[model samples]
Target: MDAQLGLRERKKARTRRAISEAAIALFLERGYDAVPVAEIAEAAEVSKRTLFAYFPTKDDLVLHRFADHEDEAARVVRARFAGETPLEALHRHQRAALERRDPITGLCDVPAVVAFHRLVAETPTLRSALLHYHARSVDALTSALLETTDGVAHQELTARLGASQVLTVLQELANTNQRRINEGRSADELASLALAEADHAFDLLRNGLAPYA
Candidate 1:
């Protein structure tokens, strides 16, 4: 029974990948807005109903790739090693991600990944959808922070504020990396600088901005 279930899940994953790949290929060829959902459904060889079942909205078709990362910050915080601060854990993760050329970190210069970034940047709907997704990510991180035994007054507000600042810093870091990549800088070329910037950013988060004043 477990084997059967595993096989079924693998099949579903393949189907989803097929649909996403087809949709992205078409979107890259002809602008995202110009490509219709029905066309994507047909290209994926799935019924429109099946496509909708897999991805509820057209925006989702593009953003589905990001779903796995929605709670990444929260997960990192929750899984931090004993005695490690949340900021430290997140900073370590960001460094590792950049080292691995993780697409989410904007350090990947793969043609497809670069194209994906371009698609999102150029599409208004995808940007709006991403903002909603970021909000959820911040909320998840806040909840994770609240779970930790960090004693402070107004815990909820502090958690939310901290999560917001951390995520925004990371987002801006990624945006900067992506901009440099888009300008033709290789990930290998930017590796040292990226790590340094990440260290500095996390230090500011850890130590507060009084140093800059």
Candidate 2:
């Protein structure tokens, strides 16, 4: 019984990948908005019904990877070390991602990845969806922060404000990296810049924006 279930799972995964790959190929070939689900199904040699089963909406075909990252920031906060603050954990995670050159970090800097980022940026609908996903991330992090602090005095307000700051910083970092890539910057150059940016961004959060003595 387990073997049968495993086989079924593997088959489903394969089908999903095939459909996604086909959709991306078509979108890349002839702009995202111009491509239709029926065309993608034909390209993948599957019926439209099967394609819809894997991806409920056209946007999902392009943005599925992003949706996975939505909960990551919150997860990092929840699993932070006992001595680590949520801000510290999130900063460390961002720095580690930059070092590893994670594409999702918006430091892909590769032509293909940069093109994908540009494609999403150029599409209003995709941009709206992306912003919605970012809001979800902020909400998740807010809940995690509240949980971690256990409803201390003003915890709700603090959590909401902190999540907003964190999300804004991250969005700025991603946008900067994407712009650098669009301007033909090398990955190594972007990585170095991102490291410095991460330090400055996190330092502000750590120490607050009070005037220095």
Candidate 3:
């Protein structure tokens, strides 16, 4: 029975991947608005009903790649090394991702990755979907932050504030990295600058905004 269930899950996952790959390929080739859902289903060799079953909405077919990263910040905090503050863990994770040229960090210069980012950025509907994803990420991170009290009053509010700030900073950094790479900067060239900027940003987070004030 367990083996059957595992096989069923693997099949479902393959179906989902096929649909997403087909959708993205079509979108890239013909533009998001130009590609019809029916056409995508046909390309994936799945019926429209099956496609809809896996991805409820058209935007989801593109944004599904982000599902794994939606709760990434929260997961980092939850599994942080003993004695490592949530902020420390997050900063370390970002630096590591940059070092590895992880696409999430926007430091990857692969043509396909650049094209994928461009597609999402240029598509109005996909941009809207991304905003929704960011909100969910903030909420998840806020819950994780709440568990790591920092001796502050109004802990819930503080956690919410911290979560928003942390995520916003990271997003901005990724945007900068993406922009630079888009403008012909290699990931290797940006590595040091990216690491330095991450360190500066996290230091500010740890030390507060005293100097600016």
Which number leads on TM-score? 1
lDDT, residue 176, candidate 2: 86
Which lDDT tens digits does candidate 2 get at residues 77-157?
A: 989999998998999999999998888778887777887888888888888888878888989999999987775789998
For model 2, the stretches where C-alpha displacement exceeds 4 angstroms are 211-213
Give the candidate order by descending TM-score.
Answer: 1, 3, 2
After superposition, candidate 1 runs with Cα above 4 Å error: none
TM-scores vs. true structure, each candidate: 0.97, 0.93, 0.96
lDDT for each candidate structure: 0.93, 0.87, 0.94
- Backbone clash numbers for all candidates listed: 0, 0, 0
Runs in model 3 lying further than 4 Å from the true structure? none
TM-score of model number 2: 0.93
Candidate 3 C-alpha lDDT tens digits along 1-213: 999999999999999999999999999999999999999999999999999999999999999888889999999999999999999999999999999999988999999889999999899999998999999999999999998886889999999999999999999999999999999999999999999999999999888787788
